[model samples]
Target: MPDVEGHPTREEMDLRTVLNALADPLRYGVVSALLREAEGTARTCASFNLPVSKSTLTHHFRVLREAGLVRQVDRGNNRAATLRTEDLDACFPGLLDLLRANP
Candidate 1:
């Protein structure tokens, strides 16, 4: 699949970067929510309802996107985010399963 602008390509995704991005509880929650969604589902940022302010939430998403854990695209006035499941699976097998299990 084509990557969202500014997102790392599947081959460029790195384990350390992903781990760092997921280290934050709020960021992990965002990813976990995406994991529970139907495969390929893209959710708008506002839908997450995270406790942080909009700017803070944007920072979280940027971190995830830069780490290659999510693909984010502009949807009109909002941004939509989808987990990079295929890329993550290819780069680090069982990682998502571990997250699901722990959560």
Candidate 2:
């Protein structure tokens, strides 16, 4: 996530959370997009976001949060999401990097 040299230590998140979150294709796509740059990336829940319904997008976010692949926080009137790269790395070394960097 944050590549800052002195970034504050983070709390270790649950592994099952991360795995279960990414189990779905939609959530996987969201995670992929978020990790493509930075966390806390915000996007609309239109079909253009992905080949899914707005309600499905909400479900995907909920699954991702419960599973731990990404962290969702309320920002203003919107909810922002970010991939838990550090927690994922800790749970499965190099797995996130490999997945993120995949061709």
Candidate 3:
């Protein structure tokens, strides 16, 4: 079986965790990129143009995953990340709009 990571269910996500994840400028940029992407789009971690090093990038992704704002799937040697847009919208109406506006 292919290795897979876990994500928090909508109910598992809370405002505090999500807010903490977005508090970082780099992670917020990740959210911004996802917002501009086509619906349900997922991108590889290396695709992000952030100036952070490899370790830092991994840390950022983990924070986002733990916060339930992003989902990462392992595909062979690469991992793809996607925004949990629908889930977030369902849980907190207009939250994505707020992120986009205030980001």
Candidate number with greatest lDDT: 1
lDDT of 1 at 103: 71
| Minimal lDDT window, size 10, model 1 | 1-10
lDDT of 2 at 3: 24
Across 1-103, the per-residue lDDT of candidate 1 in tens digits comes to 3254779988788899999999999999999999999989999999989999999999999999999998998899999999989989999999999998887
What tens-digit string does per-residue lDDT give for candidate 3 at 36-100? Answer: 89979999998988898988999999999888899998889878899999899998899999877
Instruction: Identify the runs in model 1 with alpha carbons over 4 angstroms from their true place.
Output: 1-4
Q: Which stretches of candidate 2 lie over 4 Å from their true place?
A: 1-17, 39-48
Candidates 1 and 2 compared by lDDT, better number = 1
Residue 13 deviation, candidate 2, in Å? 5.3
| Collision count for each candidate, in order | 0, 3, 0
Q: Which stretches of candidate 3 lie over 4 Å from their true place?
A: 1-4
CA RMSD (A), model 3: 3.1
Q: What is the alpha-carbon lDDT of model 1 when measured against the actual structure?
A: 0.91
- The candidate 2 region of ten consecutive residues with least summed lDDT is 1-10
lDDT of all predictions: 0.91, 0.62, 0.88
lDDT of 2 by residue, 62-92 (tens): 7766665666666676666666676767767
